[model samples]
Target chain A: MARLSRLVLERLMRYYRFLTETAAKEAVETITSGEIAEALEIDPTQVRKDFAAVGLIGMGRVGFDVCEACRAIRVTLGFNRSYEAVLVGTGHLGGALLAYPNFVRYGMRIVAAFDNDKQKIGQTVAGQIVKPMRMLKPFIKRRKIRLAILTTPAHVSQMLADRLVAAGVKAIWNFTPTGLAVPPDVLVRNEHISIGLAEIAYHLKDQAAC
Target chain B: MARLSRLVLERLMRYYRFLTETAAKEAVETITSGEIAEALEIDPTQVRKDFAAVGLIGMGRVGFDVCEACRAIRVTLGFNRSYEAVLVGTGHLGGALLAYPNFVRYGMRIVAAFDNDKQKIGQTVAGQIVKPMRMLKPFIKRRKIRLAILTTPAHVSQMLADRLVAAGVKAIWNFTPTGLAVPPDVLVRNEHISIGLAEIAYHLKDQAAC
Candidate 1:
């Protein structure tokens, strides 16, 4: 089967959100790629292709059952279950990411946070108390958390990722300056601030020139 | 010409980053869709199709000039430049995101930060001091800064965005729950957090099910 594109995954998520919001008010048995495109300002062909990647077939005129499509996307994206995860580096960036209200809502939990800071070691942020870095392996084993978020300084991202992987993490959302080098089986998503800023800078420059 | 796909733009940004880093150290000439796919583990056809969207032509085996392709992608992404922006919500999140090393490296600058609180208003972060919210418009106008990074609270986002728009903000990277409705001409990219968390939760569920 063809892999679902990130663009498709993103739209599927958006469509799922809209459908849920719509479901609260009314029964939606069918949906159309056109409607999704019009609402999201995305291309209909892209939407169709995304759905097709998931092996879903929308009805010709009747469209897709809104709930069904949402379910399918969720299942494909591994969203239909709950995931317990740990966080390393409970500093500002980590705190902000943990404060993001969507984690638990999406079935991902930050059950514990690890830090070497003496002051922060026992304190709680976003309902997760910080644990000493030494306790990482045991914590992961006990909690059965497979995902980790790294908000450590750039110099330590690789080390932090290694720590998490050693503790049995399969995926990591890295917010450090240094990107990690991990095995192919592990998923690493680098949320680089420089890249985002650079893109924005380029846009602002163009806008100014225009 | 067909518009460039977002995925291509994203990859282009990554490629640009790499080239900017290696351009001085190495003299490279060409790139192939297959090479890019191999490096990123993405589909080769996907690379070709994305490039075609922007009218970037690569020969069968000869591929494309690395520098030229880099330039083409940068132009396509409007990346031959930089942008100056402001920071709001001088709390932990605001401070850390501002202190992020990625911004300047990528091409964006946060020239100033504004806060309503007296304690934080005069403090410095990322070498830029926090200014009172009252000075926002003047600072923005003087710098001709159009993009704003908003880390304000949900209850305040609307009013804050309004003030920013009134001060001539053309784009916003919102880091709050409140979705500010703006004029179509003014671009608003909501880093809609709750939505992000919800998506995570949904993914967790799917993974757990698996």
Candidate 2:
């Protein structure tokens, strides 16, 4: 298989989501690349390239098998297997992610949650008891948890990230906007919410101009 | 000015953020596009093109004035002025976004929050009292709110979106996974959290393969 660019992979995932949702709605079996492109508002050529990169082929104009395409995407993105993870910071953002049902569907499960707030510590959130931040190291080490979902405040994000990495975390899904300086050996994904908002704001600009 | 691609504009926003954060940290007043490219991991040529598209130029060697570049980006993205927006769900995600202080920094303010939950309707989240869903229409009309931040459940998303649009919302910042079918005139931005996680999972696969 060819090495897919991050943009292509991201679009493929979006296509997969569209396909899966369509399939769930009724009896959708196959869908054309053009239809996916139109739904995603992306060019057809780019969708075709992404399909080829993922080893998914459409039958001329008949389209692709929905199940097969989804399977291929799941396999390619490593979402076919579940990974146990931990969440730090039981604030609203952290609580929201913990309650989110789709993370399990995408193969990442939050098995534990931690917070430094005395009032919040020991409370149950999303069926998991919120533990004190001091217990993070022991819990992660004992369970061998490798993934950390970080929603800590920006002021303490880097410091907490260092602590997570030192406690045997290999991946950090950071929701905070703070830039973390994790080691090369550690994987970090920053989900800056402001960037998404800015995208909408830009489009809104176009709307206003018209 | 040339029409910028959505991807380019998004990258420019990221660069603007990097520049602003760096400026906040030090006495830095100027920066090379090359340094911005390195920090963002984007090609230098692409950054140059993006800069030119926004009518910002750098000296042969002295680089660009950080303040000037930021102003250009802010103006182009329409982030220079504040936008009054409302939240439609007071759940965890809604509450988190409502409490997000950075939204103000980005020129958006959540003026109010609405939820159908009887227990939450009169309560305050992020300093805004959660109103009943019944009050959404009147409040939007009375306040002349044009922007909506939707964090409602998937089942009721489309229905509520229709109501929001009918109430004169021009744009929606959707945090739900469900696809909305709003009129062409109404803009919708879906921030699906799963897609971000899948991207991280894909990179994790590469790490494992290595």
Candidate 3:
């Protein structure tokens, strides 16, 4: 299978979510690219292309099998197995993510949370006890944890990323505003909260201009 | 200025963040597009184009004035003015966002939080007391709020969005998994947490395959 671009992967993930919901709620056996496209407000041709990219075929007018398409997306996106991850920075945002119910559905399980604050250390959050920063390296090594979710403050995020990488964590889901520098082999997916704000601000600005 | 695409807006936001930090921490007088691109891992040409699009001119060798560039980005992205927004749902995620300190920096102020849960109604999460759902409509109308930050459950998000639209919210920062159906005039930005998981999962899978 070819490596999918980030944009394509995002669309695929949306399709996967839509298909799964359609299958669960409506119990529909098959759905056309047009139906999925309409629901997602995506171009029908793009939907068909994405489906074909994942080896899913439509039966002309009969459309693609919903269950089959879901399975294909799941396999293509590597959601068949579970991924154990650790969470750093047991702040409000971190706590929100820890308590979030959807990570398990997406094949992620945050097994531990770490914080440098002595007050937060040993406190339980969403079933995982917050450990001190000192334990992070040993914990990652023992569990062979490859993923770390960094929700720490901007100033410390890069430092924590370095520590996480040195401890063998290969992928980081950075929720901080700080940009991290990691090795070529490491994957850093930054979730910038400000980007959303920028979009909203721009829209509001545009409206005011109008 | 012409309308910027979402991609351009996102890049502009990153540049704005970088420029602001550089100005504040290093007190840099001038910064080249190459410098910004290097820090952001973006193409220097693209950075220059973005700056140009925002009506910022760079000196031949001295580069663009750092503070000037920041101001241009701030005005372009509409971060120059403050925006009042209301957050729906006072769960951990909602609380986290309510307590988020950077929103002010990005020109967003979550003035109030609302939830249907009776227990959360009178409780204060982050200085602002959680208001009841019944009060949401009147509050938005009274304040003439144009933006709403939705952190509600997936099932209730669309319904609440409909109410928000009726109450005069022009933009919605949706944090739910459910895609909202709003009027064409209204803008909805869906923040899907699963997309990040999908990216991480794909990367991990690709590594395993290699």
Candidate 4:
């Protein structure tokens, strides 16, 4: 499978949430791609094309049930159960991520946090202890956590990622300024605040200029 | 003018920095969109189109000078100066946003924080006190702050936004889950962590599924 563009990934999440809610309501049996398009404000052709590319096919024109489609997407997304993630940096941002409530909404939770700071070490955030960086491997293995959130600084992002990869982290949600260069096998999604804010500032300027 | 996408806005900051370095070297005079395309790994035509859409046109063959293009983008982005923002919600995420150093890098800085928590009301983070929520209006107005970073919980987001909007805030970067329905004139951006994380999870699954 080719890596989906960030925009596509963002929209796919909405589709999943809509499907989940529709499933809960018990109003769906067979859903046409056009129905999804109508609900999501996307082109119907796009709906059919994207799902077909995902290798899921509903009965030709009979369509797919909301529950079945969501199940397929959920399974393909490895979201059948809660995902365990470890925070690589126990800094302010990392602490905030631990406290963020939305992770549990998607059945994902931070299982532990790692830091070299003595003051934060041994402290618990969101009920997960701030462990020494040395404990990363054993804790991740024990918890079967393959997802890691990298909130470390720009300078250390690469080094930290190297360590996490060595410790068996398969995916990272990177918030650092550093554009990580990871192996093809590792999955990384950049959500750097610096970039996000910069983008906003740029738009503000455009608005003002207009 | 067309609305600028978030990704382009963020890249404009990099463009600014690159132009500064180019100017300092005293070697770069006229620059082509192709050069920017090469440096940023963006398509040259795409770069030209974005700039063109903003009403900043480059000569067909002469292109644009690095410094000139940077200045044009800054003026268009309202970053020719600075914007002071206050963090609402002195919780961990708000505190972290207040402390982020790169906030200054893009000419926007968090000047203070506000929260309703009694204990945190007088406490200081990032050298700024956590003020009582009641003072949001006066302080924000007195400081002429129009842009803010909202880190409050979803349930309280509307109330907080209402207060901020009344306080004269025109734009908000919301870190909450709920998408706010602001006035058409007001800009509300949701910084949804769950959606972001879930997108990454889905991508990871997509890669593995195939």
Candidate 5:
């Protein structure tokens, strides 16, 4: 399969969510592209294209099998395999992520959390005992953990990220405001909280202008 | 100013963050589009266009004034004026949001938090005492609140959103996986955590394919 664009990947996640929800709620065995498009407000042709890109096909008039569609998406997006992730910065945001119930559903798990603060070290947060920063490198090496979630302050995030990369972390889910400098092979997904605030602020300003 | 596209708005926020950070860290009076673009890995021409869209102009040699650029982004993104927002559902995510340090810097204040849980009603989570669900309508009406951050469970999100819309909310920052059905006048920004997971999983799989 060709590389999926970021927009298409996002839409596929939405479709996966919709299909799983529909399958759980209703006894429907099949659904058409039109139904999925309507539920997601996506163009029907685009839905068909996305489905086809993921190697999904529908019958002549019976539409696509719901179970088959879900399986295809799961395999395409690599959600069928579980990923173990270690989270740094046991702050409120980190705690929230640790407690988040949907990560398991998405096949990602936060197996451990780390903090530099002596007070937070050894404390249990959302069922995961917080470890000191000293243990991060050894833990990642022992577990061969490739994914690291960075929620530390902006100033220290870069240093921590360098350590994670040097310790064999290939992917970093950055929740800090500062941009990270990582190698070409490493994937750093920056989840900027302020982007949402900016969008809301802009929309409110636009509405007030009208 | 003409309406900015979503991509442009997001880029503007990045510029704003970079400018503010530079102003604090250095004594630089001006910054070039190339400099901003390099720091963000955005195209220089696109950075210039974004600056122009926000009414910022750079000198031929000296470049744009750092403080002026920050002010322009703040005003263009509606960060100059403060917005009062109410939060629904005081979950761990909600607590993380309440503790987030950047919202105030971006001109948003979570004036209150509401939850239907009996135990959480009177308890304070991150300075704001959690209020009962019954207080949501009256408080919003009394304060004329127009923004709401929803962190409720998926099952109750739509019903809560309906109540929020009736209570005079114009924008909703939804953190649930469930799609919300709001009035045409209300804007819902769905922050799907699963989207990030999907992206990470796909990239990991893509790398393995190679």
Candidate 6:
């Protein structure tokens, strides 16, 4: 398999999501690359390139089997296996993600959530008990947790990230606006909602012109 | 001014965010292009191009004034004016965004949120009252709302989007998995958190190989 660029991987995820949703409808057993492209507003060639990179072969005219394509993307993206992860900082954003019902469908489960707020500590959020920050290291070590969702504030985000890294977390899904400094060995995916909002703002600007 | 591409606008928003954060820290008055590039993990040339596109000028050695750069990006991206938008589907995701304290900082505000759930109608999520879906049309029309945040379930997303469009929404900040079908004049920005998560999953896959 070729090393996929971040852009390709991100698009592949969108494709996978579209496929999964289509499969759920159960109205179409097979869907063509063209159909997926049209639905996603992506170019057909780009869709084909992404599918080919993942070694998925769509039938020439009949299109790709919905079940097969979904499984292939799941396997390729490592969503076939469930991952045990912890959520740090059980604030509004953290709690919302914790309560997200689709996390399990994506083969990831936030088994625990931690917070430093005394009022929030010991409270169960979305079926997980909120533990003290001190438990993060011990919990990671005992459970062999590999993924950490960092929703800490910007001031302490890097500090918490460093601690998570030292505690042996391999990937940190950052929700803070601050950029995290992690070693090359550790992976970081920053989910900044404002970036998307800004895109909408610009698009709205264009619409206003029209 | 030349029309900005979606890619460039997104990056410019990022630059704006970085500048705002720098200004908030109060440590730096003027920051060099090199510093912005380092902090954002973007190329200095790319930063220069983005700044030029927005008609912003940085000092020779001191770099760009944080406040000035932020204002420039805001004005260029249409963030100079705070937009009045509505939030559809006051579920966990919708409610989280509604409760988000920094929407105004980004130059947008959720003036109202609509939900079909009888139990939720009239209750306040965030600062706005959770109005019934029946009020969506009249509320938007009366307020001349040009933007909407769609966080509705996949099943009703398109139906609701159609109504929103008919109600005069110019743009939709969609958080649903469903791909919206809007007229060319109406814009949609889909913020799928799973895309970011899948990228992290793939990167974790690659790291495990090592």
Give the TM-score of each candidate. Answer: 0.71, 0.87, 0.98, 0.78, 0.98, 0.95
- Candidate 4 per-residue C-alpha lDDT over B136-174 given as tens digits, one digit per residue, 9 for 90 to 100: 899999998878889887779988888888888878999
Stretches of model 1 off by over 4 angstroms after superposition? A1-3, A24-32, A45-69, B1-83, B89-92, B114-139, B152-166, B176-210
Candidate 4, A1-210: lDDT as tens digits: 665666666666777777776777767677888888887668988877667655678788698766767776666555765678888887789888888766675667787889888888998877788899888888887776778999987778999898888877778999886667778888888786655665567645544554
* lDDT measured at residue B21 in model 2 versus the true structure, 0 to 100: 88
Task: Write down the RMSD of candidate 3 (Cα, Å).
Answer: 1.1
Question: Which ranges in model 2 have alpha carbons more than 4 Å from their true place?
Answer: A28-63, A205-210, B43-48, B206-210
lDDT of 2 by residue, B1-210 (tens): 666776877888888888898889886989988898888778988888888888898888888899999999989888977778989999888988888888876778889899999999899898998999999999999988878999988889989999999999999988887778899988888887777777777767777687
lDDT of 2 at B22: 87
- Between candidates 3 and 4, the TM-score winner: 3
Which numbered prediction scores highest in DockQ against the true structure? 3
Error of 6 at B190 (Å): 0.5
Model 5 C-alpha lDDT per residue in residues B69-95, reported as the tens digit of each score: 999999999998788999999999999
Off by over 4 Å in 6: A206-210
Recovered fraction of real interface contacts per model: 0.34, 0.66, 0.83, 0.57, 0.67, 0.72
* Model 4, C-alpha of B208: deviation from truth (Å): 5.4
At residue B63, give the lDDT of candidate 4.
89
Q: Would you give me the overall lDDT of model 3? A: 0.91
- Give, for candidate 6 chain A, the lowest lDDT window spanning 10 residues: A201-210
Q: Each candidate's iRMS in angstroms?
A: 3.9, 2.2, 1.1, 2.6, 1.2, 1.6
Which of the two candidates, 1 or 3, achieves a greater TM-score against the reference? 3
Model 4 chain A weakest 10-residue run by lDDT: A201-210
Query: Which tens-of-lDDT digit does each residue in A147-169 have in candidate 3?
Result: 99999999998889999999999
